[model samples]
Target: MYIEFFVNVTSKAWALPILSSLHAGIPGRQATLLTATGASRTSFAQSMEHLIELGLLERNPGHGHPLRPEFRLTEFGKESAAIAHKINSVSQGEDQDLLRRAWTLPVLASLHTPGHFNDIRRSLLTITDRALSQSLKSMESRNWVHRSVNVDARPPRPIYSAINTGGRICQITAPEISFMQR
Candidate 1:
């Protein structure tokens, strides 16, 4: 679902490449491929840090040096990635077009309030402003949501609301039944 919402390609390029590199083994000398793909080195590095912090990956100890640690996927990490890939494949269905606009839980929760993007973002932490803006535009284009811009103050803000609630979970695009179907 995240893939559909964040179709920037850059994000995919950043994530998939690293995942593919680690597909066969862990603690591989994979930095070269990360550099060769023209992926944002900084973003890729940051993601590694974030993924590690998430406890999905871990560095081995003893033989491993502190600065140059060997990494491996935790059981939870591998299972989660596997489940994500499988679910993502299922969500695309045969047409696959709808798959590009995946929705996240926070985005759905934001729509629940109907007119509080700020509150939604605060509730959803770590979502970048650029990503939120891009997602709002995408959601509006799809007619899945409605937006009202408020510019009475120094910095303008927009509030988003869902148009339909049937089968909706947090966001309209992410229907509640979709999980059961999976």
Candidate 2:
């Protein structure tokens, strides 16, 4: 359920950064959000429209000019923003890049405990094997995940575990799950 929420929220290229900016208390004006998130003018506008369409944000009809509107989070947006903030706080470089992709967070969360490929696949039921493999490879390259071989097993098997950085990402994101339960 939360994986679906994460994918929906991150569907737009600028969505995550915009949410992070809003959660950081940046003003909701178009110019402010664009500047704060460093999103291109076109991308910012499109993301704003997409967010409103998703019912995560709403314009304060009388607050600003139509061409430079102001927006505020709906109740749902607030919860989503909180999650974005938590994810953003723990990420850097490639990790941040990975978080913007759908299924990345779920994959990382599954690795909070060491797991083999099939173990993670079962945990994130909706992910494709190709997508999981790609995400894991990307994460390993970034050093967020460590892949080791278990040669002692019948046929050598690969094991994956979240390294310190990845574990911290999971730890930080844990609160977002608690928020959802509330």
Instruction: Specify the highest-TM-score model's number.
Output: 2
Candidate that would win on lDDT: 2
Tens digit of per-residue lDDT, candidate 2, span 1-182: 55555556666778888888899999899888988877799878888888898888999878998777789999989888877777787887555667667666778766767999999998777788999899889888888789999999989899998886777877766656656544
Measured against the true structure, the TM-scores of the candidates, in listed sequence, are 0.42, 0.84
lDDT of 1 at 128: 72
How far residue 182's Cα lies from its native spot in candidate 1, in Å, is 20
For residue 132, give model 2's deviation from the true position in Å. Answer: 1.7
Tens digit per residue, CA lDDT, model 1, 15-82: 43444345534343346536533456676666566557655567655645665556666775675444
To one decimal, what is the Cα RMSD in angstroms of model 1 from the true structure?
A: 9.2
lDDT of 2 at 131: 90
Task: Candidate 1: list runs displaced more than 4 Å.
Answer: 1-28, 32-38, 60-70, 87-134, 139-182
